[model samples]
Target: MSAENELLLIMERISDLTATDAEIAQFNAWCDGFKAQEIQVENFDAVSERVLLQVHRRINKKPNVFLPLYMKLGAAVAVAVFIFSVWFFSSRVKSIEEIRYAADIAPGRTGATLTLGSGKKVNIGLATAGDLAMESGVKISKNASGDIIYTIMPDNKVTADAVNTLETSRGQQTQVQLPDGSRIFLNAASSLTYPASFANKKERRISLSGEGYFEIAKDKAHPFIVDTRGQELKVLGTHFNINAYSTEAVSKTTLLEGSIVVSTATSQQILTPGTELINNGSSLQVKQVDTELAIAWKNNLFLFDNEELGTIMRQVERWYDVEVIFVDGISKERFGGGVSRFDSVSKLLKSLQATGKVQFQIKGRKIYVTK
Candidate 1:
């Protein structure tokens, strides 16, 4: 039978007043497959109590009707979904305790800086939506949506090799459309440098100082290249993410859709879709990886799946633009979960604190971590 048929059978069993043990087991197995996304609850115990109360009300209203185990479980799930949907889809929840710090730290925004070839810095975040600059017969403009677009003139010619850089400071992220029509999303504390135009270039190449997710435009004749600190990724129209933070122990290149060749001084490997190549400054290792977790920053999410405390704090430090100081020393514990990047630092910290493995104190722009 098809999956839909199977699901219907399970639902029938759940709704039946006298479901057998085997039928109840099937219903529970079906319900277990359901998962709610983009929902954050502070007090799960309170939420569960409220949900159970609603389910009891539904049960009490139906006189002479018996609710089996599966029916009760299904009712509980429905009630919980209703409660969380109201909290998540609506405004941010105010139920969580408001943890106060010395200073309020807001979340990051879509912002970056454009460094012209002449060394002049233009704050893209503060600049209005209009023509920003012109270089090598290409017009650079920012749309109302804060996307930096580059329009290459029909008669575009590069007299000199002029390079422009776009950098996002801590607590900022931005998108840029390259002259080649490729789009890139730079994460916090990331930078991308490219030539004014690729008119006469044999290959489209750019340098990235930090993490950037790329959707390379297809060009059969000329390949695209990304140069990190000591690694290079060659692409022929693909979607990928590269995390080459200098502070990171190992640089990573994760392929999402297409193939990519990751090259270092010692080795080179072609990574297939769903493959990740880790460069440890000497050699390259390829392994199957979770593409969603690798490029979660571009989607405004902090997915820490079994990531170390120190690693998670590093990401928080960049997004909050704060300094992390260990009270005694860092813990070796790792965590697995996710939270919205749109949330305040306190909410994210509270989520971490709920694990009971660590504690945090914020003072001004500094975060003190304790175990």
Candidate 2:
């Protein structure tokens, strides 16, 4: 085939349809040739320009076949230039917003709730961990592991009830124990809501946000249920983790110790230990996974196994309570490793930099990414 036809074929493969692996490989090779020529432009602009012009002339001989390819090539080159410029310049002068966005929060951040069971809102955040304080006769205490535990006094009875939830902002995490003996470790940027009393015997339910690990006290008599982002998780009593962060494209429910029934508006799946249910907006898929990886956040660790840069940043944004600024091209890089959530944002970036493909800058709570 002629050079013009080959260029037209590659452009058609990229623009009109999903490119096959072979075609994509060819296109990448072409891109590399352009990149090589670009490197010499600083020292020999005229020579580089002449070479590009000659190539363009040869490829443009067949206007009917080459017009689309020319447009696509132009777009691709523009995108490449934009990506390089952003990464090259932003790395030199870091901003506070960039740093703040990069830091991930360590687990066990301060969190508490205001119980307004009797028309009064109590400040539970200030209450010491494991110390039981009485607010209108409702006993509230922190557990040995810094989880908030609530117990209603046997004699205390009220008609009106309200639970004001306290959640760790991005970059924070906390644990809590329900009145029913169930334990919950809330992930960063997560919240949980429950009533002051178990008042109902048929079922126990709570609302959740972001992500959390749960160890439900087996009460076969009363099935425990979690409501999160339009999904429901039901179990008689079991251990599991639910990640329902609104920012995420999917809601994940991973079973650790017991069986779980996960249901959305249109689908349902029964998940066993070592199995995970992922509900994207359109469909649900259940697959087996390493239970340890799913619960790593509970242990103050950030684990990634071939995870994309965007996914990794979401975890960082939640833990450190920061924002992420992708001022450059979206990173197509995938990473696999484990890092302590306790590390500073800069430290985490340094670890990622070891890969030698991507670099980051942390200014305060923001993180800026470049390549």
Candidate 3:
């Protein structure tokens, strides 16, 4: 018989005693055979009517089988629909929770060590930001802003050699000024290492860990190079920011004024005003972006654009030094717009919870996530 007729016959026997396991298996085999057919069966109404007729016929023939067969078919149909719905919804809900979980552990804030010229190490977080004299003839002073500035005078030279290193714990942010009249703003859990003096005539260099925004001094004769996480940014004199946090997948360099060159081991690209470069270790993509969004963190704002909850939490974890745990299956919610970083963690959570999709609880320095 034709496939349609066979289906109708099976449907008719669905509630009858003759509709045994072997008969059901035969129907299943027929369905499997036609599974690869490309033709669309456009007569669903007819199929439904035929199925109902088959069920009624079976009920009249074998009343004992009517309830069990109907229940079994109903259960099978319900389970199929449930599985399909779950798959559809899951695909639509990107793995945003996984992203948030990764961001939570990603290292943006935390601890750091300062190594003096004498090879002595000082844990800056434990020590007060006051004048701490080192054996290397250097005096270290930590300002209230959490900057570690050094003053060193060569025993023979009249000019003092001053160096400044700014570092923040995993949940902290800080700013510093270089001896060369340049300024730097560091994001949470970041560090900058610079010399007391740019005595080198050809090139001046500094190393960075995490993220920093720089307003470099205008000295065309001496270029500034920022080294971080396998990438180097060279500038004659420009204002720019570098986000090379080890936890991030891409090292981003955004230029605000003048021009700069970003180079990795595999590629090099030059950037001009209003341009940003994202280096993914193996590839580089240059794009034009709003400078304000790139440097918003320095201005104490959290900007997002259809960003997942996981990404938003990473930023929070860094600035507030809090641990986040998700108790719910994993939030697939995406958030947009911006918020002030100056607000407390609870306030931020409340705003997010306002969406009615998720909730948060703060305990000590840890945040628990629920949905």
Best by TM-score: 1
What TM-score does each of the candidates earn?
Answer: 0.73, 0.68, 0.62
lDDT of 3: 0.66
Put down candidate 1 lDDT per residue, 106-176, tens digits, no spaces: 89999999998878788999999999988878889999989999888777565437789999999999999
What would the per-residue lDDT of candidate 3 be over residues 1-371, giving only the tens digit for each residue?
A: 76667765654443221233344555555444434343234354444334444443443443334433433465445334323432332232233232233323222332356655445666766767687554334445677656656555467342324455656777667665554667788888888877656764377899999999998888888889999988889998788989888877788899999999888888889999999998888899999988887898988888877768987887787888777788875577998777777766655665676665676655556787876
Q: Worst lDDT window (10 residues) for model 2?
A: 39-48
Give the clashing residue pairs of candidate 1, or none: none
Error of 2 at 108 (Å): 7.5
**TM-score-better candidate, 1 vs 3:** 1
The reply for model 1, stretches above 4 Å from the true place, is 1-102, 155-160
C-alpha lDDT score of every prediction, in listed order: 0.77, 0.67, 0.66
Tens digit per residue, CA lDDT, model 2, 185-234: 88877788776556544788888988999999998888899999888899
TM-score between model 1 and native: 0.73
